[model samples]
Target: METVAITPLDTAAGAEQSHDPLRRQQAVVALGRRAVAAPDSEILLHDAAALIADMVGTDRFLVAESDPNGGQLTLQLVTRQRYGGNKPLVHHVALDGAQSLAGYVLQVGHPVAAEHLAADRRFQDRFLSRHGIQSALAVPLCLPHRSFGALAACSSHERIFDAGDLLFAETVAHVVTTAVARCRVEQALATERRLSAGMLQTVGAIVLVLDARGQIVHINEACQRLTGFSLDEIRRRPVWDVLPVAEELDLFKSIFDGLRHGLGPVQFESCLLTKHSERRRVAWTYNTVCDAQGEIESILATGIDITEQQKRQQPEETPDANTPAGNPPSEPEERNRQHPNAADSRKVPVRRPSPINVERRSRPRRSYPYRQSIAPVQDGELPDPAEFYQVQCNDIAAGGFSFLSPRPPESASIVVALGTPPSLTYLHAQIAHVTRMRKEGKWVYLVGCSYTGRAFY
Candidate 1:
């Protein structure tokens, strides 16, 4: 089990006396080329250690890594072949002032040279004598803001390491440092990206990320489950082509436009046409992510698939079968309510209704409770009043209701007047569902709306 390095340390300790500047310059040039072409850290460090030992001459050459937590250097690569690569325990010891010179290089963040190790005040005389080392040179491995470790060479003879030796060693260290730093940064960034992607998938909600151009940048696993499309299937596609139906396209576009223009964070509910040709309702919370330039970079939307929740809340409110909201139905009415269908086929499946039997605020609550008026309603309550046409009524509930309109509302927002004339109760709602009726006849649009909790009573 004798493991050995490819390069062996020269035992001719006296050879350091003939340090050649030209040979050192050639070594530096070779190292510069190696730094650029070296595929990884281990290769770069090995070449650096070998070239230094060969060009400048060393009885011992090695690289040590900085351990910030332990405040020490951990010797990594060594050229001393005396015990082969399997040389155990002793060389791996932590260096303090009493043990070795690696600490001084790390602290000083520069190269150090000692012509006579025993005579140098900075190193212990007894320790140098015990290790049989007389002269040495060490160079710190430094970064832009911090020092990581050092590379060093030792000779058993005094005056063996000169100015030429120190300069050559530093050049080698420079090449190694730059390459190592780059690799370390790349490794850290790669790890961070993996963690980010994992966290994105960990979220249980449907996450849709749209770039500035309204392209689908990303969609999480929940989105795939709801829409029957994978990330690969929908990525980089236009949001309109992937998610929304034609009727919902323009509304989504306008909302995206406002969000890109600093609409801030908002919460709304809308329908998503899935890949299976099915509609799923989602309640979304949207916000924008901006770049360093303060321009809109992407829109982030997190939503929950509430189609089942809406379905459950629907049958609870049946037309004509139930009494008023917040009232208990009699036995006969309760039976009819369970059926969820009236005698008229048109009103049978219209649980998602528009403003049905809503009165104007001008009248009392009792005056307009069951008065089904065919009138045009206005969002009189807003700066830009939107005209809402009353459609044929169906059942009404506290959560949502359905109606038959002559045409679909331009936007999800609509106003239902509870009373008449000057004192009108305008209730705001968001269109949650829409179904097309057969043929182009009057009251051919079947619409369902959810209460938005905003009203002028």
Candidate 2:
């Protein structure tokens, strides 16, 4: 192996071309392959530095990267020949500047050479004096978007760097620029893939990705929780085998048939068997995943567990005639009071209708005065109501209340304000019933709502 020259190229004009052209071509070819084979930006930079040092006949090399905002140049790699030895010593350096030799090359967007750095007036930096450098060559690593940085080779002896030396350094810089660009693109693509996977895993609903053959390619955490099966155990299994349906088979069959014919997106309800042999009802919406050629490649299924919701909608059993339902009235006369100013009617002989009517009337009711407001409760935050409606509150109890309005509210659930005005308490209530009635030739809506939890009041 021919040792690189430490003497300045200015003094030895033909030193760079002294080697056979064929040998130089072979070396360049080898260096290009090595630069491309490196896996990441750091490795590529280290290899490029070593190759440039060997080709240029110098043991000292430095690779600096420019900051994206054009504020500074970061020295990423540094290599120096050991004293009295041919083997190079390499270490990372944190030196950075906007007015250094490397920075000048980057700023000028061209190659730069200095025969005597101590006396060079174009740029001033303490690096050359501290490192005992007398001669240096630098070339910018240019890319389409911006210049990445500069590649530099330095010498301890005072000797000039020629055009051939600078040209060779430029060639190496080109290779490094290409490698850096490739690594950045690959890293960006990897980040995108990670983000996509994380979003799927973190979603709240049960999500499944199925191949055209109906095999379960992927399932999210919610799916695993719903089926009581681990991803490792259920992956690559047929969807029908993994998620057996106990009822509504026709609904699922139709969904599957539509997916086969590319008829989705379709939604339906069906029961799914869990790993522990328990069945859960779910409402699912499915769509097709297509490839670049527009052909259906896979199916994506998203579903919500409706088992609890369905149970909540079921009607409660009727209480027997002898059984007392709900809490007794705080006072007997308070049951049908209807208004705050009404006189006590407990002593009056009221006509008793039926046992059912007596049980229904037992619920206590309190008059809610005017200007009471209601809004929807969301995530512990109260948003302004789109429109406020004055209600004639019929009565209120610990468990529920009824109010009269001209029309029903948009949502079935709302946050109701109770107690006296200005120092009121809010409670979340769900609409339990709605009745249409006519009073004095005017249409009226009797809205009944039940408190969801303990009353805030």
User: How well is each residue in 23-98 modelled by candidate 2, as lDDT tens digits?
Assistant: 5567678767876775556556655665555556664777676666666666633444432225333332232434
lDDT of 1 at 323: 25
**Which pairs clash inside model 2?**
4-57, 5-57, 366-396
Task: Mark the regions of model 2 whose C-alpha exceeds 4 Å error after superposition.
Answer: 1-19, 67-70, 76-79, 82-98, 200-457
Residue 59 displacement (Å), model 2 = 3.3
**Tens-digit lDDT track of model 1 for 91-117:** 444546445677766666678887777
Clashes of each: 20, 3
Give the per-residue Cα lDDT of candidate 1 at 11: 47
Alpha carbon deviation, residue 232, candidate 1 (Å): 37
Task: Point out where model 1 deviates above 4 Å.
Answer: 1-18, 68-70, 76-99, 125-130, 203-457
Best by lDDT: 2
Q: What is the C-alpha lDDT of each candidate?
A: 0.58, 0.60
The predictions' CA RMSDs to the true structure, in order, are 20.8, 20.6
